[model samples]
Structures are given as structure tokens and as C-alpha cells.
Target: MFKPIKSLAFATLGLAIAAPVMAEEVNLYSYRQPELLKPLTDAFEAETGIDVNVAYLSKGMVERLTAEGKRSPADLVLTVDISRLSAVVEAGLTQPVQSDVLTANVPAAYHDPDGQWWGLTTRARVVYASKDRVKPGEVTTYEDLADPKWKGRICTRSGTHAYNVALTAAVIHHLGEDGAKQWLEGVKANLARKPQGNDRAQVKAIWAGECDIAIGNTYYMGKMLEDPEQKAWADSVNIVFPVFEGGGAHVNISGVALTKSAPNKENALKLMEFLTSPKAQQIYAEANHEYPIAPGSEPGELVKSWGSFTADDVNLMELAKLRPAALRIIEEVDFDG
Candidate 1:
């Protein structure tokens, strides 16, 4: 009788057609620029039927997340610098991830002990020297930057910036407070300017012959080279991978964490696992010129051509914990002056 009606099946079919299935969606609060993450997200979306919605925040991400509280839509957080990652975790804005995939892909050194955040890629803070002025093997270590011989020649951004602070924290972690203070003072004496500009500006300063050497992240070399206007700035310097006196080159990371209020926890975890995979790491490295955190993941040819060096094994958590002390040291050293 129902089949004879020809209506029951049609009604059911119409109802099914009226309601469409939605793709799984995960929201992101990222300090990372949208362009920087699009390729990865696009790849992720293609592989998994999940949708990535990114709300890029240049600053105040923590404040916004805290304001949103439990009702927040943020499923994940991506940021550069370990200090930012540690701050998010310490602020209770993140949740610990207990995924085997994440644990397996990321080295213990690259992730939080509490599993709150994990590094995806790293960038070394290295020296950029004028090809005409600086000689090979002339500056081999971070300590060399402080030597009086380079006085009035070295350029850098404000010591208070997260990048420099992290490095300062590392110095404190390895050399002790007093030792770090001395090192900060020594490097401060070597500055060419009042520590005014960004890393790119430091390179530009070298190209302008305003300084013989500059300190910046290794990744900037690639970024500058890719920009038509900045290519000349990049071409002016020799990328040097400098290490700590007895340790390796100081490196920082671009990392990720799970939001505490993730509505789509499963999808978020999936995204987290995917990001640390070798494939994603390679994509990120090639896109951003960062060194992949996944071991044995090779960087792009451009990055490879920059040469390689030993990276310091000092736990980044230690550096994050020491950042406040490091900032104080920067102020005490009057490094900005």
C-alpha cells in the first residue's frame, strides 16, 4: 500500500535531497599569515574532508581567546616562536594532545612535556655578513659577535623582541645569569645602530654599507631573495650559520597547539598529527624556508644551498622559561641604547 502510494519513498528521497551533509570544520586562531598556511590547509582539506577556518591575528590572540572562554570556536592555534607557544600553554588556553601520531612524529625536544604544544618547523638565528668585508671562518660562533673586533659593525633588531630575547634566554640558560649579562653587554657594544629595525632592515643596512655584519634569522635570507626589491639586499650578504661556543646554532620554531575549547577535537587532533608528518613538514619548509622539525625532512634547494650547521640541543622550554630573565638582562645591559 505504501509503495502503491508512490509517495512515501518519494517523500523520503526528497527529504534526503533537501538536507545536505556538511564537511567537518575546524576553526583556527593563527598568528601565522593566511598566505603562509594556505598551501598546507588546502592540502589538508584535499586529503581530509575537513574545512579549515583561520582567523589570523597579528597580536592579542591570547586576549581574544581568553575573552571567548569556553564558548570559543577556535580549534587550533599556530604561532611562530617558542615563547608565544609557551605563553599560550601557560595561560591555560591550550589542551594537551595525547595522540600517538603526534608523539611519534615530533621529537621530545620539539614538543611540550605536557603535550600542550609541538613545533612543526625551526629557523636558525644566524649571521648575515657582507661578502666583501667578512671573511670565511671569521665568525663561527655566537660568542664571536660580542668580540670587540666587530665593534660598531654588527647590526640587530631590538634585543627585547621575542627572537633576540629567546637567544638571550639561551645565553642565560647556558652561560648563567652573570655570564649572559656580560655577553649581552659585549654584543650591545658591537651594535651599529640603536637597534631600531626588523631583520630585513638589518640585511638592508649591510647592503647599504652601514654595517659589515648583521644578525638575523636564517629564514630571512630566503624571504629577502624572493622579493624583487629585496633581492639586492639578500645578495649583499653571506649567510653564516653560527653556533654557540660549545653548542650549536640557536634555533627557534613555528609551532602548533590545541585550543582548550576546541569544539571539533577529533578533527583538530587530526590536523595536528597531519602537520607534524614528514610530508607537511616538507611543504612548510619549502613554503616558508624553515627547517623542518621532522627528522630527515629535507628543506628546499634554496635553503640547502645556504649550508648547514649543528643546531644547539638546549631545550627550548628552558629558553621560554628564561625569557623574562632574558628581557631583564636586555634592559640591564641597555642593549637597546
Candidate 2:
């Protein structure tokens, strides 16, 4: 029988290793940086007395897990981006996790139907426009970026990057294949410079007056403001949550999954449930400056200051299915060129 998660009396921890593993422990292979996860790992250890050993991987998580096979020690996998989570699932690296606590705490839209992965938080892919130049109503939707009225005024990373690909895929879902392709070509023709660099770089380009607007994830605004050198870049733009013509803003998630090879399945499930609990939700929201997956959990002050927008409810699995098509469209448009 499944159990309901009853209490969330977690004390904020300084989050260093609580103690050495003695009785029980769970191993984690995470694509998320250690700094972002330290607080959650600390709290889980405090609440359940289970030691969490996390291996932070910058890339190649699937390859590493596959190469290790069933001999692997990874009990849980944590990563940012739905596509990465989907990649792990496609590679047969994770297993289905059916838990009462999980279904109760996470909305069905944010978790896998088969329970292969559960989204922990969502980051909106929004437009950052020059506060001095682009007026409040100048740009309103993701589709608006393609208008010839804004030609030579947009900055972005390469179209093939996971973030853009996912956004492009959503457009494909709403529009037909031909519509998605035209939007890609339209936005590509409006580029300020050949797509180069990451989201933060796009904001810097906006700050430098290289372009009047740029497309980037919402959380990057919080990150830039924290860096003394990038504060000016952060100050130069107004965050705009752009919607699709008939839908809400495009959003993506950082998710967790149970590895097929998990040795400590019960303990791993405990940690996963704890992560979606209100207590752990706040810690992750505050740390990453993202929207919590758990209802009633609020985002950090800085993130709140940016205002909010409705998120599209298109199934993430649908977006995952469109990744290859999105990439094909990107290639067809010669977007980076």
C-alpha cells in the first residue's frame, strides 16, 4: 500500500555533509549543479537520516549510466530541461515510480504519465526587451518576434540549443509543420547577429544596444542581477512573458526520475517525495529562482518582482516527441547562419 506524506517539519540547514553514511544511503546522478541541490540534500538527510551521495555531471549522464549498466549505483537522476529527462527515459535509464505522495503533490501536467520522471520546477522562456527602447506594448507574443517591423532587432542563442528547440517544438504542436517552419524563418531573418552564446549573452547583447530585444529564460534575469558585473545588463531590460497566439507562455522544467538500476528504491522514493513537498519546494524555488511544481509554494522575491504569466498546458511528452522535428526545422532554416 502507498503512504501519504504527512509532515514537512524541515529545519533550514547550512547543508554540509550531515554525517557519514552508516545505516541507509541513496546515490544520485545529477545534471543540476551541486550548489543548487545542497539545501535539498541537507534537508532530506535531516528529516529521514538517509545519506545522499550525489555525482554532479555537466554532460553525458545517459552515456555514463548506460556504460555502467545494472552495476550502476545511481538511485535517482536529477536534471534541468524536459528534453534531458526525456533522453534518459528514451535510453531506458529510468524506471516508473508510482507513489501516492508524488501524484498528490505534483500536477499531472508536470509529471510523466508512466511515472518515469517528475518535474520539480518550471522556467519560462520569455523575451527580454530594452527598457529604454522597446515600449511596454511593443512586443507581446513569441510569434511577434518574427514580424518585419522588428527586423534586425532580436538577439538569441543558436536555434538548435535545447531551450529554443523545445520552444520551437511547442509552436509546431500549436501550428502545423509548415507554420512552425515559417515562424523559424521569420525569426531567423530578424536576427541582430548570427546566433552565438547563451541566454545571458543575449541579455548582454541587449544591454550593449546590439539588439533591442532578446529571448531568454526568466531565471537568467535573477542570476544576472546577482553578479556584480552583470547587474547593468540585468538593469537594461524589462522581462516580458510572451504567450503564443492562442496559448500561454512557453515553459520548461527541471525534473527527477528513479533510475532503473536503483538499489535503494524505497529511500530514493522518499527523497523524491520530499523534493516535491512544500518545504523542499521553497528551498529549490528560492535557490534556483524558479516556479515550484508543488501548489501553494511561492517563488523567491526577485522572481515574483518579474510578474507572472499563464503557462501552456501542452503535455511535455508531446514537446519531447517533437525534439527531432524541431531540430530538423532548425537545420532547414540555417538559423545560426
Candidate 3:
């Protein structure tokens, strides 16, 4: 009788042990599409056996997090670009995270000065040109896009786009707002067609002969080259590394941060550290065709193929600080109109 009782006690204790293990989970709020992020999420889950629950939305994540407030169940926030990250920080939705791995991997320029966020990967603002229409040597600098010679031959996404907006902000940092405005207006005047579509669409427009030049993030070119449906767009254009004469190529980041009211603070910190680890950095670069934040880590084949170019290295937060001004200038110039 005592042996049966002992066996039952053991089973009960086993279940109690498993309960906490099963409860070891982390919730994530991400602006990245699920398909694009699955690989990294899967790796994290496999490595730590920590179940990850993710809510993926293309927009309104900041507003949602703000609304959730201290009652929010989110532990981590992941998104693209410093502007959105800065918005989250400005809204007080994120809190300081002091992970040595993160600080070591992500350069100071690519992270929040107050430790609210850290960049994981980066994309370059590069040019794509019509292979048959434009010569490489003829277009070497972003300032050249403003020259009258390239007039009536350029294509780009709407200036309101965060990528273009950030690039414009970088320009403003290098040139005063007044000079940046003139450059923006000149580029707008040179548009071969009304600014429309994402970066890939700009490439498609070039393929259709609507324009001879387009500005886009480098990863989009890799995506187009890999997707069968987008092959024609890739084949029709050649990429150009247009360093701004004084500023170098503008770059943007995909970043992560801890939520202000995270219930799983310890777990969230672990995740942040894991993300910046060399292994995770490799995953970021390989899966996303983005440059790793960790120095000396290889940037995957697609990014490596683009060759090395100088990055502007402007403090990304400065881009955020200038966001309102940039948007105002974009509007005042009637960029979309």
C-alpha cells in the first residue's frame, strides 16, 4: 500500500515540475511579417525551449502597446527602422535594457542612447538603375540625382516612406535643412513617374521603362533576385552604391527592445542577449540579407555580393529627432503631390 502511495506522490511531483517548464514562455509584439520572422523565432524556441507567442502587425503596434500600458502582456517589441523604434521610446512604451551582448554587438550609433532599443540588423539605402539606360560611373553620388542631367529619369517610393524619410533625415544631418529641402525638391522634379509602390515596385517600374533610376534598400534587390516572379525586375536593373558626397550611404535598422511593463523581464533580457550573440547575429544576416550588428560577422551572400561601401554612421536617434522636421519638409515640398 505504501509503495502505491509513493508512486502516486512521484507522479504528482513530476507534474508540478513540468508545470513551470510549460509556463516558460515569452510574448512578442512584432511589426515584421510572420513569414519573414519564422526562422529566427523557430531557432530561439529550439535553443531555449521557451515558447514564443507573437502578435505580428504591419502597423499600429506602437498605439496598441501604448494602449496596453502597464497591463500589457507584451515582453518584447521588434520592428524595422529607427523612427518607429524612437516613436515607441518617445511614447514611453519601452524601458532601458542593459544587456552586455547587445551593447557589444550593436554599435552606439545604431542604438538608443538611453538603452531603450538596440539595432539587430541594417539595410543600406542604395540605387537601382536601368541597365540599358544608365552607366555606373555616371551616377556615383546621391547628390547627382538632383542634377538636371538625370531629370525626368528617376523613380522612388513616396517620400513619406520611412526608408526615404530616414534617408532624407540623414541628408538633413549632413546638409542643413535648407540644402536638404532643395535636394529633395530637385529629386522630386526629376521623377519619371509619380512616386508609388514599395522598393520592389520602384524596380518593377524601372523594368517597365517608366524610369531609369530608383532608390531602395539593398535587401529588396536580393528578394527580387530570389523570387521567380520578381526576376524580371532584378534583371532589368543594375544596383549602384551612391555614397552621398559628404554623408556616405544612408542606412536603417531592424531593432528590438524590452517593453516598459514586461512581466517576464528576466526572460526578455535573455532573449535580447541571445539575439545579439554571434550565432543569432548570423541568423539575422543570413535569413534577412541584412548586415549583422556584430562586427566581423559575415553579412550573408546577397549582402556580401553588393561589395563593401561606407555607411554614414550618423546617430540613428538623430534621424528620429529630425523626423518631424523631415516630414514637414516632405509635406511642404508637396513630395507626394
- The local lDDT score (0 to 100) that residue 260 gets in candidate 1 is 89
What would you estimate as the lDDT of candidate 3?
Answer: 0.82
Cα lDDT of model 2 by residue, 108-157, tens digit: 88999999999899999999999999999898998898899889999999
Q: Which scores higher on lDDT, 1 or 2?
A: 2
TM-scores, all models, native as reference: 0.92, 0.93, 0.92
Clashes of 2: 0
Task: Please give, for residues 108-138, the per-residue lDDT of candidate 3 as tens digits.
Answer: 9889888999988888888998999997698
> Which 10 consecutive positions of candidate 3 have the poorest summed lDDT?
1-10
Ranking by TM-score: 2, 1, 3
Between prediction 1 and prediction 3, the one with superior lDDT is 1
Of 2 and 3, the candidate ranking higher by TM-score:
2
Task: Compute the lDDT of residue 116 as modeled in candidate 3.
Answer: 95
The candidate that achieves the highest lDDT relative to the unseen native structure: 2
Candidate 3 TM-score to native:
0.92
Candidate 1 backbone collisions, by pair: none
Each prediction's number of clashing residue pairs:
0, 0, 0
Of 1 and 2, the candidate ranking higher by TM-score: 2
The digit string of per-residue lDDT tens for model 1 on 160-225 reads 999999999988877999999999889888888889889999999999999999989999988999
Score each candidate by Cα lDDT: 0.85, 0.87, 0.82
RMSD of each: 8.8, 6.4, 7.8
